[model samples]
Target: MTINHRAEAERHLSKASFMTGDGPNATPVNPAAADHYLRMAQVHATLATGQALVADASAYRAALASWRDIVAHFVAWGLSFAENDDEHGTYLRLAQRLDEAGLNIDNDIDKITPEFGKDPRGMWKPPTVRRAEWAAECAATNPPF
Candidate 1:
């Protein structure tokens, strides 16, 4: 059975919009909801990329914009969270990756480390493990979108 990754991407994007309170007088941005949508977007983007590798130009074209938007939203959300969370290195790593991909993240990297330095708690106890585990899990699974 062939998967329609484009449709899946749209579905995720819709969910993301709703999560961000795009509709009339809706609830404010829910962090958990935004994270959920961001993950869904990533899964669909990966699926679309896989399809494109097999010469599925339609899937690639359809998902490209959604993927870009998803990344943008994810970055924005993460940066907002990171602004206060002294122990969250995940956002900085995410920002670096996005920057490396030429996404032009406006958040300054220099600010992240200084924020951590100022905070008494500093970095997370087991730095990098949780983020690595999450990334691995995401890479391994293609959830039903």
Candidate 2:
């Protein structure tokens, strides 16, 4: 039997509620963790669709950027889950495919660093906190989609 990796990733992502709570009790889940899983689902879905469609270089590059963003989020949180998780093999496979396609994934990592800002204590704030602040700021300035 073949596994539908994209579907599996999406299932994992759905386990997190993001803005809303999950399950009967509606317990709030960690938004950062939710975002991490969502991004993981995105990475898998993008690769699945891109490969099926025979996507161009730009699409592959965008996927690489998204993957880098996930890594950056983990870095900001001071966590090594991205490097040590069970799905690490899947992540590396996708990365290798992009590399083989001539997409420089390292370039995306350089761009992701500036999005994280330092906290009052002079340490880099967690990605969850930064993402919430950014979302609030954007909502205040721009209309919701």
Candidate 3:
């Protein structure tokens, strides 16, 4: 969760706790108001969770782009990575996870290849798993041909 959102959630939760006289030093509030505060706290907590998800998604996108660029740079520099190498394995695993998560849409080579000042280039992962996942999803959704 982002700090502000988390703080907001905690603050609302604390207010609800105080209203309910959960703290020994706290005075009690009307039961209905306490319920309202509790609900508000839940809302804030949900917002915090949502913020965390958004942050994670943003980080993933940036990381994906960065990793793509790194791989491209290494290949251009003539850095040969065997299939059993850790670097290659890490990227392959990430590609597989992205495929499973339905985020394998950026597998197109031309779309990802860097143009100097452009975006990243695709890694050398075999897109078979990603392709199969996409195919299964498309079939499951029953999209019009």
Best candidate (score: lDDT): 1
RMSD of each: 27.6, 27.6, 15.8
lDDT: worst 10-residue window of model 1: 118-127
For candidate 1, lDDT tens digit of each residue in 1-145?
8888867887887888777565567768777888898788889888988877878677787798677666655544454444444434566577567779886544333334344343222333223554576677897896657
How do all the candidates rank in terms of lDDT, highest first?
1, 3, 2
Local accuracy by lDDT, each model: 0.62, 0.57, 0.59
lDDT of model 2 at position 6: 71
Between candidates 1 and 2, the TM-score winner? 1
Clashing pairs in 3: none
Local accuracy of candidate 3 as per-residue lDDT tens digits, 1-145: 3367677777876776666454565566657776887787788788888888998999999999787666545442221232344655565565556569775534443344453333334244434433566689989899777
The positional error of residue 143 in candidate 2, measured at the CA in angstroms, is 98
- Deviation (Å) of 99 in candidate 1: 46
Q: What is candidate 2's lDDT per residue for 83-130, written digit by digit as tens?
A: 333344444455456679775454443444445543422223334545
Task: Tell me the RMSD of model 2 versus the true structure.
Answer: 27.6
Query: How much RMSD separates candidate 1 from the native structure?
Result: 27.6
Q: Tell me which residue pairs clash in candidate 2.
A: none
User: Against the correct fold, how does model 2 do in TM-score?
Assistant: 0.28
